[model samples]
Target: MDLTINDRVLVVFAEKAELPVAELDLDQTFEEIGLDSLHLMEVALWVQKEYGAVIPEGDLHHEQTVREALAYLDARTR
Candidate 1:
């Protein structure tokens, strides 16, 4: 559970959505950067595969920001 990698994963998703690096604020919601449900599901799958963190469905709704996701993943890895 490398949090630095997890944080970079979040940024990669935002970058994939074509957002500028300067606008990739950790506190911003995924929706703020134009991530739809499908996009989020893809990100969830990536996290599961890359970090071995199993994120249940609908969990992303509870996490409104990248920081929140990082915290959730960090806790789960523990």
Candidate 2:
């Protein structure tokens, strides 16, 4: 399995939030980026599709940051 975490996830997120990639703070919460639960659900679904990991929607609440989401998906996909 190619375990590389796709950068496209972040790119799509940035685009959805109407922000530049450089402005994204990996440590910041999704709400801080002008995103809400709906956006997080989209991201969770995206990760499931791209990484072949079945991430539960409830798990999104635990992943408060981009770094956390990436890390969670990386572990599950691996």
For each candidate, the alpha-carbon lDDT, in order, equals 0.72, 0.76
Candidate 1 clashes between residue pairs 3 or more apart in a chain or in different chains? none
Model 2 lDDT, residue 17, Cα: 86
lDDT of 2 by residue, 2-66 (tens): 42574777787798789998998899877778888887788778877876788887786634787
For all predictions, the C-alpha RMSD in Å is 3.0, 2.9
Which residue runs of candidate 2 sit more than 4 Å off their true CA positions? 1-3
Tens digits of per-residue lDDT, candidate 1, 12-60, equal: 6666678776677778777776777777778778878877888887777
- Name the TM-score of candidate 2: 0.79
The stretch of ten residues in a row with the least summed lDDT in candidate 2 is: 1-10
- Scored by lDDT, the top model is 2
